[model samples]
Target: MDVSSIAVVGIVLLIFGYGLFKRTDVSDAFCEGAKDGVKTAFELLPTLCYLMLAISMLRASGALEALVRAVSPLTEKIGFPAEVLPLAILRPVSGSGALSLLEDILNRFGADSFVGRTASVLMASTETTFYTVAVYFGAVKAKKPRKALAASLAGDLSAFMLSALAVRLIFG
Candidate 1:
């Protein structure tokens, strides 16, 4: 470890040892905190389950595929490879689904193909915005995550655009 981290760890151990010497009831506070953490985890479980089921249903219902098809022509017009369009659309909803699509593309078209390469770049650089921010912040009971969610989506969009442009310029 770095010198600062080592020093910090040493200081923490010193303080902890001193706490034991002074016989402070720190254990009670830690136990209480752990109890609260368990309560919070239990409270969030149902919400997390619902979100997972909903996302899974969206994937299985072919609604995601419809979305992909609807947007395919526009993306194609903008010079994105048509084959990668489904992954681009679904990437924000469910990461596993997106990765499946990307893997299928790579397997069928070959990893070095333009479509596979572009999807890899896009997937690598982009975040699973809607699934991540919405589920995480909502589960955590954050009151004002609207701005954070917007920013995450914006970043994903920017990365998606950049990946598309890079692929088109470099390999189209």
Candidate 2:
């Protein structure tokens, strides 16, 4: 195995051994943790489902494409490729959706093309902000995440702009 994988296994073994040495019921603790994880997953299920449905409908309805086209002139003026716009929009809400769009960008533009590289950088730099906030806050039962959401989205926008600039400066 790779060093990282071996290190993780070693750490887990150490923790398990320490628990045993401390006379802790490790198996029961593990089972309790698994049950809690399952409960958290169930609690976040509805929000995840709703977000997936919304992302699907957004793509299927051609709204995303229309939005990209509508903003193309502005993006072009700013040296951003219109093709990467969908990735920027979808990245904040859904990782899988953003990945699928990134794959499409790579396929259409070629992996080494400026647009493809920019998409990759943007994907790497940004977070699935909405999905993360929804799952984490939902798990913690926090009702007000407006500030966090705003900050996360602002960071995403900065990442999008900076990725485009970086790719252009380095590759163009």
Tell me, by lDDT, which candidate is best: 2
lDDT of 1: 0.76
Q: What is the lDDT of residue 49 in candidate 1?
A: 63
Q: What is the lDDT of residue 79 in candidate 2?
A: 85
Give all candidates' CA lDDT scores: 0.76, 0.84
C-alpha TM-score for every candidate: 0.55, 0.62
Per-residue error at 58 for model 1, in Å?
A: 11
Q: Which ten residues in a row have the lowest lDDT in candidate 1?
A: 47-56
Segments of candidate 2 deviating more than 4 angstroms? 1-67
Model 2 residue 138 CA deviation (Å) reads: 1.7
Please, what are the lDDT tens digits per residue for candidate 1 over residues 11-128?
9799778878989776886688789999987876676565557656765797766876887788877777766777777788877667666766788779988878889999988877
Which digits, one per residue and each the tens of the lDDT, describe model 2 over residues 1-172? 5775999999999999999999999999999999999998787667666665766687689887798899999999988888798788779877766766776678878989988899999999988899898888888766899998999888888888899899888777
